[model samples]
Target chain A: MAAHNTVATSNARKQVAAGGWLWGAVRRNGAGYLFLAPWLIGFFCLTLGPALVSLYLSFTNYDLLTTPEFVGMQNYVRMATADPKFIASIRVTLLYVALSVPLKLAFALAVAMVLNRGMRGLPFYRAIFYLPSLLGTSVAIAVLWRQLFAADGMVNSLLAQFGVEGPSWISNPNYSLYTLVVLSVWQFGSPMIIFLAGLRQIPVDMYEAASLDGASPARQFFRITLPLLSPVIFFNVVIQTIEAFKAFTPAFIISGGSGGPINSTLFYTLYLYQEAFSYFRMGYASALAWVLVVLIAVFTAFSFLTTKYWVHYDD
Target chain B: MTDAVHEVPGRASTHPRLTGTVRHVLLIAISFVMIYPILWMLSGSLRPADELFGGDAGLMPSQVTLQAYSDGWFGLQVTFGRFFANSLIIAVLATVGNVLAASLVAFAFARLKFSGQKFWFALMLGTLMLPYHVTLIPQYVMFRSLGWVNTWWPLILPKYFAVDAFFIFLMVQFFRGIPRELDDAARMDGCSPWRIYRKIILPLSMPVLATAAIFSFIWTWEDFFGPLIYISEMSQYTVQLGLRSFIDSSGTSSWNELFAMSLLSLVPIFLIFLFFQRLLIEGIATTGMKR
Candidate 1:
C-alpha cells in the first residue's frame, strides 16, 4: 500500500509539471495565434495570395482567353502616358471623392445632432435617415437616381414649377457628376449612425454643466461636443474617404455603365471595371488596382499619423 | 467636454434662439424635403406608361392601379419573381454564411490561444485596407479557371473563407465582451468546447449575429457589381442586374417601366429596414467596443 501511494504521488507530480510547462507555452504564445487563425487563413487564401497574383498579372498581357504573355512594364507605361480615359476617370473620381466625403461627414453630423435633440420617435427618424445609406449603393436606388435625374423626369418637372429649367442630369456631362455626388451624400446614414453612437458616449453631464454655465448651445457644441467627438469623426472621415474612393455602383448604374456623356462620371473603379471587363485590358486594370491600393493605404496611414493632434480616446 | 464641464450656466436661456415652435416647424420642413424624392419615386411608380409624362405630375397617381407592379412582377424575360428569389437566396445564404463563418473565426480569435496571432490579425486587417479592385481581375481569373463563372459559387464561396474581415473583427470584439468565467464553468461541467459554443456563446451572441446577418443581406442584395461581372446568363441574374436590362442602351429607354421596377425592387429592402432598423442601429452602435 505504501509503495502504491508513493507511485501515485510521483505520477501526480509529473502531471502537474507537464501541465505547468504547457501553460507556460500558452501564456507565452498560444492565445494570440489561436485567435488569429481565421483571419490568417482568410488573409492568405483570399487576400495575400490573390494580391501577389494580381501583381504578377499586372506585368503580363493576359486576357481571360489567352495565355498570359509577359508584357513587362508596358501596361504601366500605357496607362501613365497614353490612356485618355484613365486620366479622365482619375480626375472625375478625385472630384467625386473629395466632394462626397466631406459633404457626407457634414450631413451625417448634422443629422446626428438633430436626432440627438430628445425628439419623439428618434428611432423612427433614424431609421428613415438610414434607409438611403442601406439602399444607397444598391441598384434600386441607382435605377431610381436615373429615373429621377432623366430629362422630363420628376426632378426637372418639379423645377419647371418655378419657371426653372433643369438639364438632363444623368445624361448631361456637365451635371451627371453632381447626380453621382448627390447619390453618395444621400447614403450618409452609416456615418450618422456612427456619430450618434459617439454622441451617446459623451457624458451628458458635460452638456448639463455647460447649460448651467450659460454657455450657448453652439458654444457647448464647439467646445465640448466637437473635441470629444473628434475620435469618432476621425474614424468616420477615414472610412468615408475610402468608401468614396471605392464608389462604383452609382456611377456605373446612373451613367448607364458607359460612364457616358463623354465619361464625365467615370469613377476610378468603374473605369477599372471597364478596362478589365469591357476593354479586356486586364494588365492595365491590374496596374490601376495596385495604384488604388497604394492610394488608399497612403491616405489611411496619413489619417492615423495625423490623428494624434485631434482624436481623444479616454484610456 | 472638459470645457463644457466648467460653463457659466446663467446666460444660455437669455440668448434668442430657435424657440420650440420654430424648431418644430423647421424640423418638419427639412423632413419633408428629405422624404420628397422617395415620395416622388413612389408616386412615379404608380403612373401609367404614357401618363408618366403626358399628364401634369401629381403627388398621387390619378389612376391608381397595380398594373405596373403586376407588369414588373409578371413581365417577360426578367420577371420579378425569379429576381426576388435569386435575391432572397443570395441574401439569405450569404448572410448565414457570413454570420456563421465570421462568428466561428471570431471565436477562435477571441478565445483560443494560438501562435503568430498579431501578424495574422494585421494581415486580416490589411485586407480591409486593400481596394477590392486590386483583387478583382485575379479573382475573376480564379473563378474562370474553376468554371465558377455564371454561377452563385463565385458570389458565395469566398464568403465561406471569411472574405470580409470587418465583420469577423466586429464579431470578435463582441465575443470578447463575454465573461470568460462562463467558459471556465462549462469546462468544469465537462462540456466540450463545441458544446459550450453551441449552448452558451451563440445564444448570447444573438444581437451581434443578427446585425451581421442584416448587414450581409443588405450588402449582398445591393451588390450589382458582382452579379454584373460573374453572372452572364439571363436566367441567373440577380434583381439588381436584372433591372439593368430594362434600360435599353441604344435609344430612348422605358422610363415608366424602369421607375415601376425600381420602386418594386426597393420594397423588400425597405421593408427589412423598417422592421429591423433598431436591431441594425444597435448592432452598429455596440460593435467594436472593448466590452
Candidate 2:
C-alpha cells in the first residue's frame, strides 16, 4: 500500500512536469506560431487533408452527387486491363516526357553556352528568349499554336515556299503530339536562364586552363562543362519531365478537349480532367491522380537514387 | 576577368570584331524566329478577316484595321472589358494575398525558432514537388460543397492562406540573406517580433516582395485550369475563359477577332514583362541557382 501511494505521487509529479514543458513551449513559440498560422491552416485544410481524402477516394466509386462506394482496387484493375484510353494516355505522356525534356534541356544548354561567351546585348537576347516561356502556357499561345499548325497555317505556308505541302499537323495523330513537344521545347527559355546561371558559377579559369592544355572547345565542354553542369541538368530534367507529364492546356486546346485523333494527345492530366469534370468519375479520377502522384514520386526517387552516378557536387 | 578569358581564345583564332559580328547575326536570327509567331499574330489581328489566313507567312499586314479589336471587345454577351475587370480583381487580390501571407510564413521559417519548424518546412518543400492533381479532386469537392464552384473565392482565397510554397521558399531565401542584426536592434528597443517583421524585414525586402507580386499576378492572370474548373458561368468568366469561349462559340469564323482578344489577353502580362524583365530574370536566376 505504501509503494502504491509512492507510485501515484510520482505519476502526478511527472504529469505536472510534462504540462509545464508544454506550457513553456507554447509561450516560447507563440509569435512564431502566430506568423505560421495562415500557412498551417492552408497546409492542413487544402494540401494534406485533400491528399489524404483523395487517397481514400481512390478506393471508392464517387460521382460528386452520390456517396462514395468502396471499390477495392477495381479502378486499378480496370486501368490495367479494361481501359484502353488509360493505356493510350500513359503511352502519349511517356512519349512526350521522353521526347520533350531532353530536347528542351539540350536546346536550353546550347543557347546558354552560346550566351555565356561574353557576348554583347546579353540581356536583350535573354529577354527575347525568356518571352516565349512567359507566354507559352497562356490560352492565347495555345490558340495561336492551333492556327499556326492548321493545314493552311503559317508553318505550312512557310513550307509552301519550298513546294512541299505540310499536312494539318494539329489534326494528324502522328504529328499532333509532336506539335505539343515543339511548344514545350519553345519554352526552353526558363531552363536556359537556369542553365546560364549555372554556367556563370563555373570558373572561367578552368576553361582557360583547358585551352592552355590544347583541349578543343568541344573537348573542354565534354570534360569540364558537362560534369560541372550535371546538377543543373538533373534539376532541369526532373522539373521538365514532371512538367511535360502535367501538360494539359496545349493538348486540351489543340485536341479541342477530345483527346482525339485516336487519343494521340491524351495527356495524363487531360484524361484525368475529362474523367473527373466531364464524365464526373470523381473516384476514378482520384485513382488516376494517385497514380500520377506515384509516378512522379517514383520518377523523383529514381532521379535521386541515380544522382550519385552522374550528378557531381563540389563538396 | 571573364571577358578577358573569353577574348583570349577568340583573339588567337580570329578577329574579335569579326566574331562579335557573327555572334550578333546569329543571335538576331534566333530572336526573329523566337518572336515571329507573336509578330504574326499581331499582324493577323490587324488584318481584315478575309486576309487572316492563306496570306504570305511574313509578319506584315497588307491593310491594317482596328475592326477586329472593336469587334472582339463587344463580341460576347459580356464584353471583354468585363472579363478584364474580373481577371484584374482576381489577380490583384491573389497577388496581395500571396505577397502578404507568403512573407509572413517565410519570416517565421527564416527568423523565428519554434518546435516542429523543420518538419513543417520539409513538408512545405515536399508540396513543391507534389503534383497538384493529387489534391485537385478533393479540393474541387471541398469548394463545391462550400458553394464556391462558380465564384472567384476558390481562386483568390487559397492565396491568402499561402498555398503557393514556391513564393514562400523564394521569400525565405531572400529573408535569410537579410542581416539579423537589424532584428536584434529592434528587439533591443523592446520591439516585438511583429514589429521587427514590419519595420526591419519588410522594408528591406522590397525586391523580393516585388518579385513575388509580379510573378503572382502574372501566374494568376495566366491560370486557365483553376478558373476553367471553378467557373462555368459565362458572365463570371476570367480573361482566359472568355478567350476560350470565343473560340468554342465562334470557331474559325471570327479568327481575326479571336486573335485580337487573345492579343488583348496577353497585354497585361506583356507590359509587366516589359517593365519587370530585370526583376523577373534575377528572381529566376537566384532561386534556381540557390536550388
Candidate 3:
C-alpha cells in the first residue's frame, strides 16, 4: 500500500513537471508568439483551410445553393475529353505564355540596356516607361485598349494616313489575342527596371576589356552580357509567365467578359471566372483552379531544376 | 584623330557628338511613343464626341470641353462620386491593416528568437508563390456563408490578417538590415518587446512602411476581382466596377464620357506615383535585388 502511494505521488509529480515545461516555453517565447498571432491565424484559417477545402470541393458537385455531392474524377474527365472550351483555353493560354513572356522580356532587356548607358535625364525616361505598367491592369487602360484597337479608332486613323486599311483588332478572332499580347508587351517597364538594376551590378571593366579585345558590340553582348544577365532573365521569365497565365482584367474588359470572338481571347482565368461566377459551376471551377495550381507548381519546379544549366551565380 | 580618341575612350569608330545626338533623338522618340496613348486618351476625354474618332490621330483637341467630365460624374445609376468614396474607404482600411500586421510579423521574424521560427518563415515564403486561385473558391464560399457577399468586409478583412505575404517579406528584408544592437539596448532599458517594436523599430522603418502602404492602397483601389466577385450592388461598387458598368450600361454611345471617367479614375494613382516615385523605385530595386 505504501509503495502504491509513492507511485501515485511520482505520477502526479511527473504530470506537474510536464505542465511546467509547457508553461515555461510559453513564457520564454510569449512575445514572439504574440507578434506572430495574426499571421498564424491568417495562415491557417484563410490560406491552408481554404486550400484543403478547395481540394475537396474540386472532386464534388457543388453550387452555392446545394450541399456538395462527391462525383469522383468526373470533372477532370470532362475537362479533358468533353469540354472543347477547356481545350481551347489551355491552347490560348499556352500560346499567350509562350509569346508574351519572351517578347516582353526581350523588349525590357533592350530598353534597359539603352537606359543603363549613363544618359542624361534617366529618371524622367524611367518614370515615363514605368507609368504604363502601373496603369496597365486598371479597367481604364483596358477600356482605352478596346477603343484604340477598334476599326474606326485612333490606330486605324494612323494606319489610314499610311494608306493601309486595318481591321478592328479587338473583334477579329485571328488578331484578338495578339492585341492582348501587345498590351502585355507595352507594360515592359517593371521588368525593365529590374533588368536595369541587374545591369548595374555587372562591372564596367568587363565591357572595357571586351572593347580593347576588339570584340564587336553584338559579339560582346552575346558573350558577356547574356551570360551575366541569365539569372535576372530567369527570374523575369518565371515571374512574367505566372503573371501572364493569370491575366484576367484586360481580357475580361476587352472581350466584354464574354471571352468571345469565337472564344479566341479565352484566357484560362477568365474561363474559370465564367464557370464559377457566371455559370455557378463551383465544383468545375474548383477543378480548373487546381489544374492551374498544378501547372504553376510544375512550371516553377521546372524553372528551378533547369537553373543549373543556364542561371549563373557569383558564388 | 587624337582629339577624337581622347574625347571617348572606347568609341574610336564614331564621333562622340554624333553618337550622343543619335542616342538623345532615339530616347526622345521612344518616350513620345510610350506616352502617346495616354496623351490621346486625355485629349479624347476633352474633345467633343463627334471629333473623337476617324480624325487625324493627334494629341490636341480641336475644342476642349469639360462636358464629358460632368456627364461621366453623373453617368451611371450611382454617381462616380459614390464609387470613388467606396474605393477610398476600402483602400485606406486595407493599407492600414497591411502595414500594421505585416510590420508586426516582420519584427518577430527579424528580431525575436523562438522555436519553429525558421519553419513558420519558410511557410510564409511558400505562400508567396502559391496561386490565389486555389484558395479563391473556398474563401468565396466561406464569406458567402457568413453573408459577406454583398459587403466590403470580404475585401477588407483578409488584409488585417497579413495574407499579403509580399509585404511581410518586403518588411522582413528591410528589418533585417537594421542593427540588432538597437534592439538589445532597448531591452536593457526594461522595455517590453512591443515597446521596442513601437519605439525603436517602427520609427526607423517609415520608408518601408510607406512603400508597403502605398502599394497596398494602389492594389486595393485597382482590384476588380475581389469587388467584382463580392459586391454586386451598384451602390457598393468600386471605381473599377463602376468603370466596367459604364461600358456595359452606356454601351458605345458615351465614349467621351467613358474616357473622362477613366482618366479621373487614374488621377489618384498618378498623384501617388508623382509624389512617391523615389520610394516606389527604391522599393522595387531593393526587393527585386534581394530576391
How does model 2 fare in lDDT? 0.91
lDDT of 1 by residue, A160-256 (tens): 8888888888888999999888878877877888888989888888988887766878999899999999999998888788888888888887777
Across A97-151, the per-residue lDDT of candidate 3 in tens digits comes to 9999999989989989888868788899899888888887899999999988988
TM-score each candidate.
0.89, 0.95, 0.96
Which runs in model 1 stand beyond 4 Å of their true positions?
A1-41, A211-214, A313-315, B1-18, B54-57, B249-253, B288-291
Please report the candidate that would top TM-score against the real structure.
3
TM of chain B, each: 0.89, 0.94, 0.94
Best by DockQ: 3
Candidate 2 chain A weakest lDDT stretch, 10 residues: A111-120
Candidate order by lDDT, decreasing, is: 2, 3, 1
TM-score of decoy 2: 0.95
TM-score of 3: 0.96
Of candidate 3 chain B, the 10-residue stretch with the lowest lDDT total is B7-16
DockQ comparisons of all candidates to the true complex:
0.45, 0.61, 0.62
Give a tens-digit lDDT track for model 2, residues B32-103. Answer: 999999998898899987774864788888899999999999999999999999999999999999999999
